[model samples]
Target chain A: MREAYHDQLGELAEQLASMCGMVGDAMELATKALLDTDLAVAERVISDDAKIDDARARTEEDAYSLLALQAPVATDLRTVLSVIHAAESIERMGDLALHVAKAARRRHPQPVLPEAVRGYFAEMGRIAVDLARKAEQVIRTQDIDLARVLDDEDDAMDDLHRHLFSVIMAKDWEHGVPAAVDITLLGRFYERFGDHAVSVAKRTVFVVTGKMPGYSSDATDL
Target chain B: MREAYHDQLGELAEQLASMCGMVGDAMELATKALLDTDLAVAERVISDDAKIDDARARTEEDAYSLLALQAPVATDLRTVLSVIHAAESIERMGDLALHVAKAARRRHPQPVLPEAVRGYFAEMGRIAVDLARKAEQVIRTQDIDLARVLDDEDDAMDDLHRHLFSVIMAKDWEHGVPAAVDITLLGRFYERFGDHAVSVAKRTVFVVTGKMPGYSSDATDL
Candidate 1:
């Protein structure tokens, strides 16, 4: 029974890694769609979200099944629950990517980002993909150290978000209200994408350390 | 042992309902602070979030302890896990409220929402409280009917969110880039608060119906 349970856990981990990869690809494609104004790429990202959703659903079902069948305790219990948590974070990341794609698609051949802030969006996209990839590695290996390092990456995204705001608010700002609205929402999407990756990484750390963050830590603080 | 486990589940439900109330109050106060430029109220909202976090932590710990001690299966397992899920959604609502508070604080004395848009924000705040109250009742009563109705409430929020974007994008929009940015983020925070409430309600529906939402259903669609 124990061997069978461990096998199920191994399967869960594989599903998790796959989810991370799918989310990473979704964000990357969504970014490409935004930067290149490629409707096909944006369509792909929107259509591909179903796969990420399915992956998350499968992971959750497996976790619930394991809990019911194996009734695993202590670290094992935490592992199953953490898998659910991480999958949820990754799913939200996929959703954020989809939002970016929708924004790109909404603009169609016209660029979603203003020319002045495209560079900031590009850097945000790059950081988001990097964090998603790192989240995958952390999940695959359960590397607490790598998971901890995601905080710094998330901080970088925050910095970029702040920079985007500064550009919009600059004295020489040329973009009108519509462009500012797009930039604001796009920056938020990218920032939240990074946030969900950090959330997954933090839960990975919790699963390994068995220490939940204290009440003092804000949800986004993770 | 079964009776004791059932009692624990009942206690968990109470904690979740209380959390709903706390988060609802936080958002209400945060909205007031934002609209009124009341710093003291904003500070209270920020400080009170710790209580919501603590409640969530305690509920999770109890759920974990129940799973380990009782090894609940089938319905019992789903019930405990749903409690945890509802608590998590409520915790996130609290975090969104905290973000609203911080936004209010960041702009101190200067209102976050411009005078022209204050009415729209007021409506959003009113709807948020209404949804939170309904979520609490759903948790307490486990009313699948009530749970299903949250979707419509959530839709109302989405409409408000769309209206906010239109307002921001209107050619007549006079708010500068900074105000626009703040309004955009604030609208998102309120929309997300409604989203989380709907999530909790959907889980409640799932627990009662033993059915999951179809893949085509959007997250906000719930």
Candidate 2:
């Protein structure tokens, strides 16, 4: 019985790592849909977000059952609790991906991003996908060093977010108000995706080190 | 010992309710700062966000201790878990309010919103604060009926968000791209604030009903 209970706890971590992969795929496809104007791919991303939500629900239920039935204590208790926190952060990453895909769908054939600003988003998308992948590896390995690396990547994402704003506010910006609005929101979605990815890494660190990082919140305004 | 354990659980609920109030006040002050262009008020909101973050950390620590030392099971376990989840949602609410204050600060003295769309934001701010206040009441009372009312309030917020977009996208909109970008992000911050508030209510309902609502995710793209 004890062996099975421990297995369940390990399985919850595996589930969260898998969730990271799911959202990474969603973000990759969503970025493609945005840049390529592929409505079908965008639609697929939008619909598939449900699966991520379901994954979170299942992980939470498993963790809750572990807490209730197994009555895990000490390190085991922290593991169960961290699963719940990590699951919420990963689920939010999926939602950010969904927002990206929906942005692609909103403008359809016209292209959501103007040509001048498209490269910024492409780079942002690359960094976002890489962050999600790294977060998955961090969850699976519990490597604090790798988890800390996510913080640097998040810095890169913030730089890109700030650069995008400079482009919008530049005198050469000819996309007008609507396109600028789209770009602003798209930039925010990617920035927040990075934040949540860092947050997932932070939660993993908490489970391993038994101490939360000094900064609890990951939010910042552009 | 059992009675003390129950009191700790009750205190967790009270802590969450107080968190709701903290964020509610933050949102109110943020709105005031944005509308009035009061840098001092925006500065206060920005600084006070630390208090909300501290509240979340304390609540989570308390909940974690309950899970570790007391090893709460069944309803008590659920209550503890829900405290973790609800605290996260409330913290995000505080972050959203912080975003609003930051937006106001970023464009200090110049006002983030132009004369044309200020009314829309004014209304959005009002609804966001009301939703936060109602969410606090729901957390305290565990009143599912009051919780359901949050959904209606969220719908109202969505309407205001959409209306703000319409005004920004109107043909006569002369606020230019920078202002449009600011309005877009500000609108999104309030919309997300409403989503998190409703999420808090849903978690309260889950603690009472032993079931999560059908709609697991509250995110949607404009």
Candidate 3:
């Protein structure tokens, strides 16, 4: 019974790591769809979000079962609770990717991003995928060092987000208001993707270190 | 000891409901700050967000302690877990309000909304406050009917969000790209505020029914 309980806990971590991978793939494909205006890929990302949500539901149920059946205390209990928190954060990462894909689909056949601003989005997407991958690694390994790396990547994403804003607000912006609005929201989606990754990392840190890193303010701040 | 555990559970509900109230006050003041361009009010909202975060930390700590020390099973365990979930949703609502307040501060001395679209924001703010208040009531009462009302209120928020978009995207929109961008983000903040409120209500419903309401999709969709 003891060993099985530990196995259930390990399975929860595996489920969470899988979710991170799913969201990473979603963001990567959604970015490609946005840049290439591929309606098919965008649609795929939108449809795949359901799978992530299902995974979250399954993980939460498992965590609840573990708590009720095993009555884990101390670090074991914290681990179960953290799994629930991290699952929600990862599910939200999937939703952010869905938003990116929906943006791509909404302006199908016409690129959501302007020519000059495409590079910023490409970099942002790359960082977002990287953050998601690292988040997966952090969850799988409970590596505090890797989790800390998400913070730096999130900073890079934030810088790219600000740069994207500057470009949209520039006097010579010729794409006009509609495109600007799309870019503003798209940029926000990518930035928030990074934030949720950091949030997942923070939850992992809490489980491992027994102390929350930077608990005063979350990464979702505007 | 069981009585003490039940008391702790009741305290958790009270803490979460108070958090809902704090965020409700924050949104009301934030909307006032945004509409009036009141820097002081905006600044107050910004600073007060720390209090909400602090409340979350305390609530989570208490909940964690209860789980660790009490080792509650079945309904008791689910109640503790739901409190954790609702605290997160309420804290996020507070963050959304903080985002609104910051937007107001960023455009201080100049109104964030143009005169033409001020009515939309005023209504959005009113609805956001209303949602938060109802969320508080739902947490306190755990009334499924009241929880379901949040869904209709969320629908109202979505319609306003769409109408706000149409206004901004209108050909006669004279505010230009920058204002459009601000309004886009500000509009999104309020919409998400409503979404989180609905999320809180859903968690309460889950606690009452032992099943997640609308578990397939969340209210955060674009």
Candidate 4:
């Protein structure tokens, strides 16, 4: 029975890793769609989101079943809980990508981003993908050091977001309200995607160390 | 021992309701600060958010403790899960309110909403308060009917969001990029606040009926 429970736990980790891959793919494709103004790619990203949501729902059900039947305690319980949190975070990332895709679709035939801000978005997209990839690695390996730096990695995205704001708020800014709105929302979507990626990493750290990030030094091990 | 667990569950419900109340108050005050350009109120909203975060953390600790010690099953388990989800949704609502406050603070001494869009924000604020209040009541009463109708209530907020977009996209719009960015972010904050409220209500409904809001008739009850 114990072996079965451990096996299920392994399966849970695999599911989360799979979700990370899917979300990473979604973000990459969505960013491409945004940068290229490709309606087909954007539509694909939007439609592909259902797979991510379904994966989350299934993982959550697995978690609920494990909690009910196995009644995991201590680190086992935290592992399961962290898996659930990670799944949810990944799903939110998928949703953010979907939002980006929708924004791209909305501005089809005309790129949503003005040329001046496109490089910033390209860098933001690169940072988001890097974060998602690192998030996947942390979940799979439970590397505390990797998890520790995920937040610092997120700072790059934040700086990019702030830079995007400066571009929009520049005195010589020429884009009207519609383009400004698109740029602002796009910046936010990328920044928040980074946040959820960091959250997944932090939750993994909590599972391994039994210490929540930014909390007290005390470990709340069960 | 069973009675003690039941009591803990009751306390969890109360904590969630309290969070709902605090979040509603935060939304109201933040909107007031934004509309009136009141720096003091904005600061208050920003400072008060920590209290809400502490409350949610305490409530979540209580939940983790209960799950660890009590090993609840079936409907009891579902109830605990719902409480946790509600707490998270309410916390996100508080964060949304915080964003509004921050936006107001960023634009301080200058009103964030242009005159033409103020009415839409006013109505959005009212809807947010109403939804938060209803969310509190639903948690307190477990009123399935009330929970079911919360999504419909969200429609009004969505309509207001769309109307605000129309105002932003109007051909004669005079607001510069900064104002447009502020309005776009502000509108999204309110819209997402409404979404989280509806999610809390939907989770409540699921707790009551063992049915997900949009899922098929398959009953996954334990």
Best-matching candidate per DockQ? 2
DockQ of each: 0.54, 0.75, 0.68, 0.41
Count of residue pairs whose backbone atoms collide, per candidate: 0, 0, 0, 0
Candidate 2 clashes between residue pairs 3 or more apart in a chain or in different chains: none
In order, the Cα lDDT scores of the candidates are 0.85, 0.89, 0.90, 0.85
- DockQ for candidate 4, C-alpha atoms: 0.41
lDDT of 1 by residue, A1-222 (tens): 999998999899889888989989999999999999999999999999889988898898899999999999999998898888888888988998999999899888898877889899889999999999998898789898787677787887888888778889787898787888788878878888887888787777787788754322223321
lDDT of model 3, residue B140:
91
TM-score of each: 0.95, 0.96, 0.96, 0.95
Q: TM-score (0 to 1) of chain B, per candidate?
A: 0.95, 0.96, 0.96, 0.94
Candidate 3, superposed: residue stretches over 4 Å from native: A215-222, B215-221
- Sliding window of 10 residues with minimal summed lDDT for model 1 chain B: B213-222
Give the per-residue lDDT of model 4 (tens digit) for A1-222. Answer: 899998999899889988988999999999999999999999999899899999999998898898899888778877887787788889989989998999899878899998999999899999898889899999889898997677887887787788889889899988777888888888888888998988888888888888888822101000
Pick the lDDT winner: 3
Q: What is the lDDT for B23 in model 4?
A: 98
Q: Give me the runs in candidate 2 sitting further than 4 Å from their true place.
A: A215-219, B215-219
Model 1, chain B: what is the TM-score? 0.95
True contacts kept of 3: 0.68
Look at candidate 4 and tell me the lDDT of residue A143: 96
